[model samples]
Target: MRLLCLDLEVEDKGGFFAYPSDFVELDCSHKPINQISTIVGSSNGLLCLTHRYRNDSQYQYLYVLWNPSIHKAIFLPVPDFRLNSNRHYALSHGFGYDPTTDDYKLVRVVYVDGTVPPQVEMYTLRSGGWGYLTASGPANVIADWTLSVFMNGVVHWLAQTPNGEGNIRNVIVVFDIGHEEFDEMPVPKSLEGMEHLNMEVAVFHGLLALVPCNGNEWELEGEESYSIWVMREYEVVESWTKRFDIDVGVGLRRVVGFTKNGEVLVIKGGKLLSYEPSSQEIFNPHIRSRTESFYFSTYVESLVLLNVEDGE
Candidate 1:
């Protein structure tokens, strides 16, 4: 329950540059910094980053907690779980702060060979170690590349679980940070069988929101609109409501999360676009990338990890 002061800004120059107020581009020319695997999640201004590198014949990954404002970082120790070279695995991560314990926690779920009940582990800042969770995870495989939203001390993921008829369906997997419990919530009834399309759980205007598009941008030949669904009340399945529809038209690649002012950040072709719901207009901040690759996360500047030492 660590309260975050949203929209606070700071000036600092480094590998990551904030653009149009939200997106940041990594400067790969920086050594060691280039190893950032993914910008997993953020809480209280501390970023959870995974660094992957090749050690001799094996690959190794280290989790880093960093506060760009203070230029301080702490590298977490390797988890007790060992990689099985014979099998392939996919990793999903969630980060948040538990105000009850006054600790920051990182949750990692490893799916070995696309199997269910994935191996789950957590790293607590105060404990300074990683511990394995014994609970049985959701039977569904959490969607790769889908976004996870942290709200009200819980992290929600969009996953597709198989139904009784062997057909895949979408479900919201919930993980409570303080209790370290796993649970499942049903998605809006309209999106039940549409798991094939791109969908994500996002926070809109202080409520848990869902954004689902009709088709992938590359596959759509015509215009398409995305539906914004928000839960009027937390944990109340019946409270889910379709707030509005955003018509992004053609070449809308992805919905890149939202801005503090409630504008929708999206990707179109090779540029970043912001759509304002009230005005029903789209504005380009003139941000472009040669590769058309963008990673979006709401960043805040603080001194959360300023006291942590390396390798602690």
Candidate 2:
């Protein structure tokens, strides 16, 4: 697989910065100094990003380039909306590429108020327009948080159901582009946790996977303390299994992404480790970092399969 590295100068404030201003793209296949400014959020691959211009009310926008060979970045100029507000309330929420129509869709979940049902807005790459999605319950249910996973020409988000005052249960909400529908799926019971442990949903081995943070006790035991659950079968609730248990002592913080060969790529401390699931063997591909003061939390970035062949 090919790896491309881009040197980005991000704002010191927390969360992802909108595209054009906060991103830099590098072409790894060819030795060129040409770096394109990314048009989407740095967290996910599919979402396009928009930032409020300091001088003007208009929002500056950009999109991510999936092609490694094309070092040039495409800047899409679209109509502005009031949704381009603060960076914290604004998120590059959900994204996905549809093969049937050969179109890419970018969605942003805008949390207007700090409480109640959350407001969601969508932007399509094909149409170069922004619109709104009909929320199921009150706007306060989703909160001002972003939780999304893309699979099969659709993006899935985690929905929250408040029990009483501060108690809440998480559910899965899926957006299908082909049919243009939003559906809900029940979350597995084993994945429940406290509020601090932010859970993430992912697709591994063509099956749904949930990665939960250990919260208060996660770092207490160090790297060995964290565990990831993988669902072997999709749309089946009982197919869940504790696929991997990480040892924080060895520097395993969490599983970032899975390789095409079914191996898991893990991030431990500031290092990257590749683990073969079947053999349970871990390989430390020590990727040297150029940054002098590297913080574990600041290293958060998206990982994608670079060299995997199509239709594999």
Candidate 3:
């Protein structure tokens, strides 16, 4: 369980998927998505990276805690916060596991100055930590692609209003690692207006899902027809259910979560499809040849990543 992709070009027959015939690939060729800039969440199997650069001009921020199933990586430690400008941004990032202090946390949403009013941090890898929630972040939503969706133990995102400045309305930004609270979850009010629509925040079955992808109409061999919405009641936000309508001829390219038999794990073009909406079939969990990125996230292979200090 682990699917990641970004900006492409890391081909080389990488691996993941402990269940659909079990694949493994992780020899570490500078792999943290090769110095990623975004993948910020995934619990139980750890994976929360953020590596923005530009040093000579501020904007540093580095953090990683990967665990590609024992390829074990930990590289975290650079958060005394002091960016001031490079625009000082980052609107979402969360990694979970707080089973009442078994620790392993990482929540973020900084905005030194993207539009002001957004700073909330927490690191705590068993107390070799960093913390500053100071009463939880509230900067009128967040933009630049907010992400973070670790179910039950809490950690969810999808809120935008800051740089868009006005009434954006569509909240769901929780974070409750054993009472370190900061809640607001309720998004399926018959949802719509997906900014451009392709929404994500997944983890179905283990609850807390929402996989919107309405891209209907496209027959030119480019296949297009979508409807992936799910939220069969994680305490009901009207139970937003529509799970998989996929005419997906190709190009959803990213829905990387699901398949505990619920199957809907996608990543078109770069291969790795498994969408089986009750026989709408699209098999091939063999993870086709040297695949590339379309962005991914789905993990579960822990040893607590062996406790930090491996690749800083």
lDDT of 1 by residue, 57-115 (tens): 55667787877667676778889887756777777778889999999999988888888
Q: Summing lDDT over every window of 10 consecutive residues in candidate 3, give the lowest-scoring window.
A: 216-225
What TM-score goes with each of the models?
A: 0.82, 0.63, 0.31
Candidate 1 local lDDT, residue 203: 84
- The candidate that wins on TM-score is 1
lDDT of each: 0.69, 0.47, 0.61
Candidate 1 has which clashing residue pairs, if any? 1-99
Cα distance off (Å), candidate 3, residue 148? 3.8
lDDT of 1: 0.69
Ranking of all predicted structures according to lDDT, beginning with the best and ending with the worst:
1, 3, 2
lDDT for each residue of candidate 2 in 257-293, tens digit (9 for 90 to 100)? 5655666655555555567756778786554221211
Question: Model 3, residue 154: displacement in angstroms?
Answer: 23
